[model samples]
Target: MSDPAKEYKQLKEDFVSNLTGGSIGEINLVTAIVPVSVLLWSVLQKRHSFFKPYTVNAFGLDYLINVGTVLLSFTLYSSQPLLLNALLIVPALAFYLTPPDSPTSRKKPDVPPKAKSKHGATATPDALGALPLKPFLTTYRGSMIVATCIAILAVDFRLFPRRFAKVETWGTSLMDLGVGSFVFSAGIVAARPVLKERAAGAPASPLAPRLVRSLRHSLSLLVLGVIRTLSIKGLDYAEHVSEYGVHWNFFFTLGLLPPFVAAFQSALAIVPSYAALAVVLAGLYEAALDKTELGAFVLTAPRTDLLSMNKEGIFSFFGYLAIFLAGQGAGMYMLPRNISPRPGTTKGAQRKTLLLTMAAWSAAWAALYFFATSYDYGLGLSVSRRLANLPYVLWVAAFNTAQILACCIIDTVFFPESYKAVDVSAEEEAHRGATSRLLRSFNRNGLALFLLANLLTGAVNMTVATLDAAPILATGILVGYTFVLCSVAIVLDELDISIKL
Candidate 1:
């Protein structure tokens, strides 16, 4: 008979893809390959006439830079091996390639539409359709988030990233990148209440209306949480071991915390609200994990298993709430005030204001991160999602702030007129080019894509013996998986269907 312990160890090694040394190289290759494949598909679909030098050349440059970054990361793994960090080069390239008059640049081009629709019916003035050629900074962030989430899911299930790294070891393991991208994006998105309200064309909501909306959103989260929990249990996959080691998947925390976060923000100002929540939650987590009777009880009260998730799992939501609230704080600063295109301010002036704000906030958060981590490093309190302590909060906030700075810099280089084209009518958006269609596909149905990917992860795990697939085969499978998922989002976009609660 096989030794279960030995069998288990091998299973884990295969699952995380660290079975072979130097799995980082493989992971980078997969990341580059998938995006490049998608870009190629977009090119084929758009079919800009073969002689269209500008469009074709721009896309070619993008593809080359993307692939080159992956290879460079792989080759330099010994010196600077963080592939995700290396991938940041793509945005830099994108920003550099965006000339003042380029369609992809921040400056709105005066060029006429490629052509009117066959039916000549006006298309709706949809932000989703505008995502492609003129993606805003936030749009890029959002797209990367979904893409990263999908990539990690593919890796964890052993379809790709066949060489894996442990989550705790740090240095941009696939698991951390996946979870961090999701959580980080969640925080930023949570910060956008003003923008959301304005976009919906509702007059600034009173507290009551906002509360009602928050509650509804919270209810949706709970329902989705239940669905995820039951779905995992039903599939007999809850017990399937993961890096988290706890009863909770990231989704569980995602579901349980958003409601509390929403309720907390209903009264407090964005920054102070999350700050206070973070303080309270972190304190509770520290205290509960102490060596006292209460701590012991808290830790052991609900023993966790596949069948019955631990109550301790719920406590982790406290940390997640802090993270979410912090994200809301980010949104308040990053997004335009009142979302009315800042009347009387030219786009240049608006960009300057945003850049200055991001710079100052980035500096403040960096200081917070340094101080908090210096104090907590000895106590094992740095960047722990389970604790969601001050250091973790600062780190996430600082990292996000830095990314925002990058976005602002990119915007300045590219010239952001597309995002500022807020007053354009619906008919104008419909006649947009292929790039918008592709970007909007992921942007509009983000939640749906996430849900679909989760469902597909489970399905793949159940049907395939993924733990030992060859790296090439696994990469191909993952690329195909992503393409299909992205296609779903695109099709939904075309049909103007968004799965929202």
Candidate 2:
């Protein structure tokens, strides 16, 4: 008789293989959970007295609405995403339409009139009227992390539909989106330090020192990559080698990026914009994949040596780097350089500039995605997460930019006064509700939460025959796993403990 362990391993491998992804519209709707959940929570805070009791002590409610609901959508209701979306939307709309108690309503304080300028407009105040982007960014990123954590282990069970698993070679799925989203999110945040360094006019350092500093910054990721490789090989864990390669993992991909980006910093200066640089890089890589034998080598070459063994990881690095640059461009455009407006710029002008920039960026990315993917009028390339090719990069950029835009719009529409251009004081920040605090916790301890989830996933796989578990049993296990992850994040945040490394 065949060994049960080997059979189980093979079964698991087959379970996630040879699959095509679902529609982009559906994926976008599923992603709506992030912003819509916040909107729903805000409406509840305003309209429901019954919910008021839990407002002060809302950890349970927070978990149920934010974490638990996401878990359900990705598992139990994975097939009926539209129904799931409707359930969330209907309640949020109903509650939002209802009038709030006068005592509970927060009215904006009146501002004293300022002197008029020569243009007959109110003199621009030092502080620009700009909505806070941090909360929206945090929510978007936290939700992505939460979804990744949930899907990592859930994909092992029958309850988690195969449609959501990572595609084999070319296609889209929730899991496929997760990997790119992680890279994109990292790129988005990575922009701040680089821009700040430029703005501060840091003294030019030698390349050797710069390289060393970049490597030092990335040391933890490299170390983790090593540890993960050793553990997987030592434990003989089941792995889909094609996902990265025989020896390579995503941590290595992430670890190597900072140094490569640093090396190219000087070259990048010649390019007018990071977005343009990204397009150039991706275009060149895609041309190489199509015009040369490199594409065949990545897809079908034998694993003869170390280089060939890890070709996918090595080659895909360029595509990921391009994604990173795109994200950096976005960050430079969106994030404020100073707390106040430029000397001569009015609040109205600043707001208009911000909106127009966001819109243009979104439109450009969307157009690129369509052109890259369309066979009739543009490059007829299929998206390949495995290759991290041009189409994949464009799709990720477009999807994320749109999501960011959506979140901003949602915040402006539902909580206008709160997210208004006026600077939010510490007092206003402190008065934020429990749901906001919970979302912030995820952002604060993001890496820690991801690591914990990975460890727990390994443990669960070793302890249980996930493929053999019944649907209800699998779901229960997932619920327990999610609770543990969220609880750890909340506790760490409450204790003001942030694990940077």
Candidate 3:
């Protein structure tokens, strides 16, 4: 009979939750039910097909699980951070331990018609050569990464699950914009090209058809966008405030631009070389004018809708757009499935690349750190949204991207081949062990661990003021709560809990 919002207020008094996309979040803001509903609907549509393998039903279930994990992570987030981190390690470990239901593990006749399934989204690679009319709707890595970013943004913006992170403007920018949104978005940038439409049987084009790629990207982001809005609604349930009209969600900007990408993809496809140069010029122009006192020169106006408008994402567009376009170009020429080891190559080139990326990132960071904190006028000015500060945005984007690329280089050095090798020397093994440990720290199972960490962190805050649970305890509960919550997630993820509710 008592109100939950009132109850939460009583418990903490000042919890900051700026939740984003709702379901899988727009796979973002909605409850676990939304993705299940979509997947079930898809399954129902195919049920009547005489040729519909019962296996397809299983794939639907997997989709449901993946989305469910997203849902679970947010639920855990509402509790604690450290607990959530611990909780995340479980499922990925289970996936590793489980006999990987390899692609060929079961044959058509052997798989119970109803039981055959796949874990990832429905990206059955296009057959040998022909381009599929519609690209795979889900399961594409790029779209998934994009969805992840939008979902997290939704979590930060729309919902007041735990508490808004109170940080110095710069610290807040670094934490929220830097590590959170920017880090995940970089993965999306790296993976974007992989999401493009590839014919079933043809030599893969350097770039996917722009329109198809854009639509695929946009549609996914849009669905996530709606969930983002819904998440805000949910946050209102717990913390009543009217943040509904604020339109600063970057997903909207991103979704809107895909059409633009599609429209221009074909034309620009011809002049591939100009793509990078154009983006660089545009970004510099946008940054200098909008991000500083000299912003007037670029003639870029900040957001000014009468009802509600944000100048962050779009106004600072050219900078990020440059990053994105540059990413696309890199995807076209740089990252690909086929990599060969040159005669003298044995981690030498990879190490060199990693070192260079570090050097660039470090140099950029020094310049940016000084410029970001010391400057009078910053990208912080918001015609659109405060969250999308241009200087902060570029600094984080460039830094994060550089870091990710460097990581990829290291990955290439160790992985030379995609699969794990049976025999290896101690030195190489030691190198891999360190990298693997680092990576496993944030791999997919990371969600479960993060949730668990949240709970433990909460419990710690309530009971003991270990250095770990200081201000976080400032909310409610204690480190003990953090421990228990994370314990649950770690157990669950490790078990690979298949329940889909």
Candidate 4:
């Protein structure tokens, strides 16, 4: 055999080359830097003490650090760890920059003796007790949606490092997690409220209303995706499949499943239902592949119309449903209970509680990950987006949880004003700074940006040769693309012209 040391050296060289050569992980890091920097600066402005005067410098420093972090993350460690840490660090840095007298600035005078409920009555209840959790959840979902769009743009422009783009053999690239977690978070956000309503004996929206609007929305997007492909890339269905990996809104199918799975609400019911369904489908798919005549055909088939629609596309609906249900289960745990308002939790205590919760859950998921990957039942659990297998679901949940935990830490520590419902008024929201505006804009017009990115991707490919771009040039193009998208979306948001499905 060849020298082992030599082989490892070659592999290390290849890894470095791939990372610097526009890897997806690197691109994702790059794309995430701006939004995250904006968020950090927004928090700094909200602090309104030492930071208010240094706002410009803080923004510049945050952006510079973000850019440098991208290099360090991919070079020192992998993207995932660096990203999770970077997200968590933003709030801590904001906290550090917070002036000693900042809280005193916002502190209200002691309540009048006549108005006091008790001698020591307080205006705001503790955030740890029961903070308004919906805003946090909404922010997480919206942020993920925008981030997902950015990641996709980075990938489409041939900015993703070619080394990390090996979807077939790669067990789970950072890119895969980005896509998978986006879908999972989407499912959680979309169904969490509705499912909670059903559980609480609240009347369900009629199935026709529930699915039709969402179905139409997804269909419109699908149509737009297709038209953009045709107009920009030419009318090549086969190539579309090759490029985007099966042309259909996985979200559409996710939207369609909730009505059917409405009866399965509790973990006792939903978890087992998903488990049984996943097991049966996995068995059937495997058996069909191993033993049936159709298996041979599928194995040998090219990207024909039949294969695309049946095996590659629609067949995965079942697996996608499993992933969605898994997200619903996660949502149930993370999201606040849908109940009447009560005394809200204190921001400080809530932050501690959430940090503990996140740590415990991370550990739990890590164990699950170990079991799913190591202890195989003859049927292996692979991370197939098409199959949405057990290991895949667990891994997605694990990492998504960690990422959200990081985000929660950031929100609670730096921007505690947004921790509760009452703090978010139309006037207050309207007057928010550019960073928050950008986030909310992207959140509100998320699907629009997604579609826009698709069109833009096609347009860029048509005009420019993106494949052989240097890393710096590719990053510059990404910055410009993001600026344009954000500017348009921000204006629309300012005008309250959200293009909702």
Best of the two (2, 3) by TM-score: 2
Candidate 2 ranges with C-alpha deviation above 4 Å: 1-19, 46-57, 104-133, 201-206, 337-349, 416-435
lDDT of 3 by residue, 121-205 (tens): 3222222111111111112222233224223322333233422222322223222432333323433443334434331234444
User: What's model 4's TM-score?
Assistant: 0.67
Give each model's whole-structure lDDT.
0.50, 0.75, 0.36, 0.51
Range of the 10 consecutive residues with the lowest summed lDDT in candidate 1: 45-54
Summarize candidate 2's per-residue lDDT along 97-202 as a digit string, tens digits: 8777675454432242454556776544334322234555776777778888898999999888787787777778778888888888888887777666766678
Better of 3 and 4 by TM-score: 4
Q: What local lDDT does model 1 show for residue 421?
A: 53
In model 4, the runs with Cα more than 4 Å from the true position are 1-43, 46-135, 156-159, 192-201, 205-217, 225-310, 337-361, 375-380, 420-435
Tens digits of lDDT, candidate 1, 1-501: 644444533433443343222333444444443344333323332333211232545444433333333333322332354454545545444543444233453333336543333467543334333122233433445445455545544555443333343333222344443455466567666656555665577775566665666666667666776776677667667352323333455655665555566556545655355545565665565545443343333323354554334433455456556656666666665655322255687656766776787788779777766665464553433344433445555666666666556545644443344444543442233223323344456666666677778778777777777777765665556656665675576568658797875
Q: Which stretches of candidate 3 lie over 4 Å from their true place?
A: 1-172, 179-184, 187-209, 217-220, 230-245, 248-319, 323-344, 357-390, 401-442, 445-501
**Candidate 2 — worst ten consecutive residues by lDDT sum?**
426-435
* Candidate ordering by TM-score (highest first): 2, 4, 1, 3
Order of models, best lDDT first: 2, 4, 1, 3
lDDT of 4 by residue, 1-501 (tens): 554444433442443333323333454554454345445544545555323332445434533443333333332333464565576466747665766454657534223222222355532332122223344454556566655555554664344544344254215565556666766666666555655675567776655675565555466645654555455346441243422244454444544555534434333344354334433444455444334443333222466674554454455455455556656556655665323233575645555665687667667665665675563633333444443445556667676666666565655555655543342232133223223444556667876777786666656666666767766776777666655676677668758897864
Q: Name the candidate that leads on lDDT.
A: 2
